[model samples]
Target chain A: MEKIKVKNVFKIFGPNPQKIIPLIEKGKSKEEILKETGHGVGVNNANFAVEQGEIFVVMGLSGSGKSTLIRCLNRLIEPTAGEILIDGENIVGCDKDTLLQIRRKKMAMVFQNFALFPHYTVGENVAYGLEVQGEDLETRHKKAYEALELVGLKGYEESYPDQLSGGMQQRVGLARALATDPDILLMDEAFSALDPLIRKEMQDELLVLQARMQKTIIFITHDLDEALKLGDRIAIMKDGVIVQIGTPEEILTHPADDYVRDFVQDVNRVKVLTASAIMKKPDAVVSRKDGNKVAIRKMQEAGISSIFVTDKERHIRGIITIDDAMALLKKGEHSFESIINTEVPTTSPDTSIVDLLPIAVDTKYPIVVVDDDKKMLGIIVRVSVLSGILGEEE
Target chain B: MDKLQIGIYFEALIEWLTNNLEPVFEGLRTGILALIEGFEAFLLFIPSYVLIAILVVLAWKIAGKSIAIFTAVGLLLIDLMWLWPQTMQTLSLVLTSTVIALLMGIPLGIWMSQHDVVDNVTRPILDFMQTMPAFVYLIPAVIFFDLGEVPGAVATVIFAMPPVVRLTNLGIRQVPEDVIEAARSYGATRKQMLIRVQLPLAMSTILAGVNQTIMLALSMVVISAMIGAGGLGEEVLRGVTQMEIGKGFEGGIAVVILAMVLDRITQSLGNTGKTK
Candidate 1:
C-alpha cells in the first residue's frame, strides 16, 4: 500500500504565488523566476510515493527544496498547488481541523536542531503531542516513558532539555515524535546537527527502530552517504525539482544525468554495496545426503576447490573441500556430513563490503551468504566484491 | 511645505474624542480611582513596622539576604526622615500605574507579535508615546480626570506603557523559529502555541519590560505631584516653590530610597525568570 502520495506539488514563496507558478512551469530557472516575478520557488512540481514501511529519502544540498518538499507532505508549509494523499485521502485540500487531526494521528516529525521545548521537562516534551490531543495525563505519561525507553532514554524524564547532551536532546526529540505512534514519520535533517560519531550512532539507532516499528518514513537529508545508507529508495533534488529517484544500488550503478553521476562519483561505494549485490549464485551445491563422489565430481566440473553442502530444505550444512570429498569417496563414506567443515566464514546478504573486508581477506573459499534462517543464498568471491566496490563494467 | 501643522489635526482629534467618548473616560476614571484608593487604603491599614517586615521578607525571598537588608535600611531611613506616609503614597501610585501598564501592554504586545499589520500600526505610535515629554501627557490627563492621584497614574501609565509593549512584542517575535515550528508541527493550536511555547520562552524579556515600566512610573512621581498627586513629590514641589532646602533634601532622599528598593526587586525578578 502507498502510505503517502505527493503529486505535482508546487510551493512558490512570494506575494503572488499563482502568477509566478506559470513562470516555474515554463522551464524558468529559480534565479530567472525570482528576477522576473519577485518570487522564490520552494518545491517545483514535486511528485513521489512512499510505500508502506519503506524509508523514502529526499536528498539535496541546501536550498534544493528537499526540506520544503518534506514540509509540504504534511502541509507544514502550504503548497501553492498539488495533491498530497495519505491513505488515499487528499490532505492538500484538508480543512485546518482535518489537517490538525492528520498531524496528530497520522504523521510525526523529527527536526534537525532537537527542537525540544527548553522550559519543558523531557517527559512533558514527550507528552506534548498527547496533551494537545487531550489525552489523560496518566496515559500520556506511561506512553511517554515507553517512547523514551525505545530511544534509550529510560530515566531522564524529569530532567530539562538543557541538562542533556546534544545527542540525548535529539533522542528526546525522537521520543516526542514516537510517543504519538503515528504511521508516517517525517524526519528533516534529524541527525545533521549531531557530532559525526553521534550522528552515526543515531543513524544506526533509527535503522534499528525502523526494523521494529515498520513506520513509513520520509527522510530528508543533504548527505548523500546517509541517504544511501538509510534509504530504501532515494530521490535526488535540484533547484526545487526532483531530478531522479532510484534504489541506492540503482542510483550508484546508473545515475540519470551528469549531475547525479557527479554526486555518486565521490561517494564511498564500499560502504554502500552490500554482500547481496556482489554475491554470485553458488555453482555447485550438493545435498548432505548426496554421495561424496558426487560432491567431488560437481566441484571438478565447476572448476572449484570447494562445494557447499545443504539439506533438502536448502539450509546450509557446511562446505566440503574437493580433497576431503575425494578422500571420503575412497573411504566409501555414505554421508558427506562427516567431512563437511561448518567452520567456513559466512555473512548475511545485507552485510556491506566494508564490513566483509577482513572476513573476505582471511577466507580461502568464497564467503557463504545466508538468510536469517541459515538458508544458503549465494557466495561472495573476492573478485566480485572488488568489482562491486568499483562500479559495474560498461 | 511650510510646517505641515499636524498638531492642529491632533488637537482637533483629541477634542472630538473628548466630546464623544466622555462616558468611556468616566468609566475608566472610576475604575482606576477605585483601584488606587483601595491599594492605598490597604497599605495604610497595615502598621508601618509590620509592612516593613513583610517587605523585607518578600525581598529576601525574591532576591537575597543582602537585598533584604538593603530594603530594611532604606525603608527605616525613609521612616526616620518623617516621610513614611509620603513614601507609602508614592508606592501606591507606582504600583497602580505599573499594574495598569502591564495589564494593557502585554496583550497589546502579544497581539502585535501575532499580526504584522498591528505591529506596523503601533510601532510609530509607541515611538511617539515613549519620546513625547512626560509633561505633555499630564495636560490631557488633567483635563480628562481633573488634578488628582488618578490623573497622575493616567499620565504615568501612558509614559511607562511603551517599554512593556515593545519588549513583549520583540520577545515573542524573537522566539526561535524552529521552536515555533516544532510546536505547530505537533498540532498545537494557536492558544497552545502562545501559552506553551511563546510566552514561557519570552518570559524573561517580558519581565524586563515590567521592570522598566515600574522604573519609569517611579520617575514620574515628582512631576505628577505638581498636578496635586500628593506623595513625596508634593514635598519636593513645596520645597521648590518655597525654597526650603531641608524639606527638599528629605523628600529627595526618600524618593531615591524608594526607587532603589523597587528597581532592585524588579530587576531580580527578571533575572529569576531568565534562570528558570
Candidate 2:
C-alpha cells in the first residue's frame, strides 16, 4: 500500500506562488515573466507515491527539483496545486497544526549539510523534534539517547556540530531524525556533503538501519551509485519530472530509455551480483572407499542437504547417498569425485537472490560459483544468499 | 604604488570631471533656495537621536561593560567640548538617515535575492551609488531635497546604503544552499525561513553593513553642516573657517567623541553577530 502519495504537485515562484505557477505552466517562460512583472518557476508538475517499508531513492542533479520534490512531500514548500495523502488522509493544504503533527509523528528529513543547529549540542539537536512535539525533557532526552546509540554515536551527546568531523555531524543529523521515531525518513543528499570514505561508511550504516528498523525512506541523491546502493527502488528525475522508477536490477537490466540507460551506463553490475553460479554437472560415479564416519562428517560440514564426492585432485566424481555413508566403514581409500553424479547444474555468479533460491533448492548438492568462464569459484546455499541480502545473521 | 598616491583627495577628481563638475558648484550658489524648498529633509531628528542612545545601550549590552564605559566617555567628551547639544542634533540627523537607508536598502537587497530580474536591474544602480564620491555626491541631494538636516540625511543615505544592501544580500545568499534546501524541506514557511534561516545566518554581514552605514552617516554630520545641518560638524566648520585653533581642536575632539561612541557600539554589534 502507498504510505505517502503526491498527486500533480506544482511549485512556482512569485509574489503569489500559489497563483503564478499556472500562468507560467500555460507556456509562460521565466523570460516572458521577467518581460512582464518578475519571478519564475521553482518547481513544475510532479507526482509520485512511495511504498510502505520500501527504500525509495530519488536521484537528480542540482536544480533538477529532486530536493524541491521531496520538500513538497512534507509541505515544506507548499505546492501550488495537487493533493498529498499520508496514510490515506489528504494533507495537501494542511494547516500548521496538522502539518506539525504529521512532521513530528510521521515524517523526518536528514539534510545534505547535516543541518544540525550549530548552537545546540549533538544530543539536543537529536532531541529538537521531540522537544518541538512537546515531549517532556526526560522522555525526549531518553529518546535522543537511544537514537544516538542506534546510530553508534552514544557518547557524542554533549558535542557540538562544529566540534565533530563531517561524518559525525551527519550521524548526529541521522540520530536527530531517528529520535522522532519517524515512520518515513527523507534524506536529501544526506551523504553528498561528506567525504567519499565517510559517504561509504554512512551508506553502510543506512543499510544496517534499513535492515533492522525497516523505516520506509525516500532518499534524494545526485549520484547514481548511491541510488543503486541504497534504494530498493529508485526514481530518476530530470527537469522536475520523474523520468523512471523501478527496482535497481530492473533499471540496470532494462533501462526504460536512453536517458535512464545513459545514467546507469557506468555502473558495475558484477559487484552487485552474488555466488551460486555455474555449478558443474556431477561427474560419473566412482567408488568412494572413505569410511562412513569420514563421509558423514564431510556431509555435515558442507551443510548441503546431501554430500557430493570428489577426487583427491578436486574433480567432482559422483554424489554419495546418506545410506552409502551409513553403510560405509573404515577408510577405503575414498575420494568424492569417484562418487560424483553427472548432473550439469549451473548458474551465473551475478544471479540475484530472488532468482538464486529455486536453482539452489532444486540442487542435489552445494552449488558451485563461477565467472563468465567455465571455471569454478566456490559454493552457495539458500542461507548464504539470504545472509548476504539481509546483511547480518539475524 | 597605490600607497604612493596617499594624502590626496580632490585634485585628480576635479580634473576627471571638469565641466559637469562646474554645475555642481553652482548648486552651492542655490543652496539657500534648495534649503527652503526641501522640507521633509529634517525628519525625526530629535527623537531618533534619543534612539541612537538606546542603540548604544543595546550595543553595550552585547559588547560588554567596557563598550558602555567607552560610549559614556565619548559622549562626555562631546559635552565637555561645549558641542553636546549640537552633537545631539547631528546625532538625530544621522539616526534618521541610517534608519531610512536600512529600511530602503535591506528590502531592495532581499528583493534582489528573491529574483534574477530584481538583482539584474538593481545591481547597476547599486554599483553607481557605491562609486560616486561624497563632494561629488552631495549635489543631487541638494537639487532634490535642498540644504538642511533633511537633504543632509538624504545625502548620507546615498553615501552609506550600498554596503548594507550588498552585504545583507550576499550574507543571506551565502548561507549553505543545502541548509536553505533543508529548511525548505522541513516545511518552513517563507516567513519562517526569512526569520529563522536567512536572517540568523546573514546577521553578521548585515551588522557590518549597519555599522558602516552608521559611521558613514556620522562622518557626513560635518559635511552636512554646509547645508545648514547642525551637530559637531557645524562646530568643526566654524572652528576651521574662523581659524580658532583651540575651537577647532575641541570641535575636532568632540567629533571624534561622537564617532568613537557610535563606532564602538556598532563594531561590537557586528562582532557579536559573527562571534556568537
Candidate 3:
C-alpha cells in the first residue's frame, strides 16, 4: 500500500498564489516567474508516492524546496494546488479539525534543529503528542518511557533539554516523533544539525529501528552520501522540482542529468554500494553428505578452485578445495567433511562494500554472503568489488 | 484663518462617553474602590510586626536572605518614621492598579500577538499612552470617577498598562518559530499552542513585563496624588506645597525602599521562571 502520495503539488509563496501556480505549470523558471509576478516558487509540481515501509529521501540543496516539499505532505505548508493522499485520503482539502486529527494520528515530523520545548523535561517533550491527543497521564508516561528506551535515552527523562548535548537532544526529538507510533515519519534534515560522528550514529540507529518497525519515512537532506546510505529510493530535487528518482545503485550507475551526475560523482561508491550489488551466484556447491568425488567433479566442471559445502537446508557448513577433494577421494573418503575448511570469511548481503574490503583482502576464496540462518546466498570476489566501485560492467 | 480643531472631536468623544456610559464608569469606579479598600484593610489588619515578618520571609523565599534583611530594615524604617499608614495606602493603590492592568493588558496582548492588524493599530495608540504626561489622563479620570483613590488607580492603570501589553505581545511573538511549528506538527490546537508552548515559553518575558508594569505604576503615585489620592505621594505633595524638606526626604526614601524591594522580588521571579 502507498502510505503517502503527493501528486503535482505546487506551493507558490505570494499573494494570489493560485494565479501564479499556472505560470509555474507553464514551465516558467523560478526567476522568470518571480520577475513576472513577484511570486516565490516554493515547490514546483512535486510528485511522488511513498510505499509502505519504504524510506523515501528527497535530496536537494538549500532553496531547492526539499523542506517545503516535505512540509506539504503533512499539510504543514499547505500546497497552493494539487492533492496529498495519505492512505488514499487527500489531506490537502481536509478541514482544520481533520488535518489536526490526521497529523496527530498518522504522521510525526523531526526537524533539522531539535525543536524540543526548552521548558519541558525529556519525558514531557516525548509525551507531547500523546498529551495533545488527550491521552491519560499514565499511558502517556508509559509510552514516553518506551520511546525513550527505543532511542537509547531511558533514564534521562526528567532532564531539561538544555542540560543535554545536541546529539542527546536530537534523540529526544526522535523519541517524541516515535512516541505516538504514527505510521509515517517526516524527517526534514533531521540529522543535518548534528556533528558528523553523531549523525552517523543516528543514521545507523534509524536503520536499526526501521528494520524492526518498518515505518514509512520521508527523509530530506542535501548530502548525497546520506541520501545514498539511507534512502530506499531517492528523489533529487533542483529549483523546486524533482529532477530524478531512483534507487541508490541506479542513481550512481545512471544519473538522470548533469546536476545529478555531478552530485554522484564525488560520492564514495564503496560506501554506497552494498555487497549484494556486486555479489554473483555461487558457480558450484557440494552438499555435506556428498562424497569427495562429487565435490571434485563439481569444482572442475564449474572451473572454480573450491566448492562450498552446505547442508540439505543450504546452510553453509564449510568449503572444500579441489586438491583436498582429490586427496580425500584417493583415501576413499565417503564424505567431504574431513577436507572442509570452516574459516572462510562470510558477510551479509546488506554489508557495504567498503566494510568488506579488509575481509576481501585477507581471504583467497570468494567471500560468502549469508542470511541470518547462515544459508549461502551468493559470493563476492575481489574483481567484482573492484568493478562495483569503478562503475564498470562485468 | 481659524485654529485647527482636533481637541473639539476629543471633547465630544469624552462628552459622549460621560453621558452615555455613565453606568459603566460608575461600576468601574465602585469596583476599583472596593478592591483598593479591601487590600488596604487587609494590609492594615495584620499587626505591623506580623506584616513585616511575612514580607521578610516572602523576600527571603523569593529573592535571597540579603534581600530579606534589606526588606525588613526598609519596612522598619518606614514604620519608625510614622509613614506606615501612608505606605500601606500606596502599596494598596499600586497592587490594585497592577491587577487591573494585567487583567486588561494580557488578553489584549495575546490578541495582538495573534493578529498583526490589531498590533499595528494599537502600536501608535500605545506610544501615545506612554508618551503623554501622566497628569493629562487625570483630567478625564477625575471627571469620570470624581477625585479619589479610584481615579488615582485609573490614571495609574492607563499609565502602566502599555508596557505589559507590548511586552506580552513581544514575548508571545518572539517564541521560536521552530517551536511553534513543532507544536503545530504535533497537532496542537490554537488554544493548546498558546497555553502549553507559547505562553509557557514566554513566561519569563511576560514576568519581566509585569515587573515593568509594577514599576511604572509606582512612578505614577505622585502624579495620582494631585487628584486627592492618599499615599506617600500626598506627603510628597504636601512637602512641596508647605516647603518642608524633612517630609519630602522621608517620602522620597520610602518610595525608593518600596521600589527596590518590589524590583528585586519580581526580577528574581522572572529569572526563576526562565530556569523552570
Q: What number of backbone clashes does candidate 1 have, counting pairs of residues 3 or more apart or in separate chains?
A: 0
Q: A1-394, model 2: which lDDT tens digit per residue?
A: 8998878777766686766666666877656765676755556666788888889999878877788788877876777788888999888876777886787789889988888776568897788777666679999889999999998998988887889999899999898889888899989899999855467678989999889998889999999878888999998877666778889989988888888887776554333434532222332222355644666676566543355554454454445665555444333534444343557355565666557767767875556554565444445644665565554421
| Most DockQ-accurate candidate | 3
Consecutive 10-residue window with the lowest summed lDDT within model 1 chain A: A385-394
- Candidate with top TM-score is 3
- Measured with C-alpha atoms, the lDDT of residue B61 in candidate 3 is 96
- Model 1: clashing residue pairs? none
DockQ of each candidate relative to the true complex: 0.54, 0.16, 0.58
Candidate order, lDDT descending: 3, 1, 2
Error of 2 at A81 (Å): 7.3
Candidate 3 lDDT, B22-117, residue by residue in tens = 999999998999999999999999988899999999999999999999999999999999999999999999999999999999999999999999
lDDT-best of 1 and 2: 1
i-RMS for every candidate (Å) is 0.8, 3.1, 0.6
Question: Chain A TM-scores, one per candidate?
Answer: 0.70, 0.65, 0.70
Per-residue error for B22 in candidate 1, Å, reads: 3.7
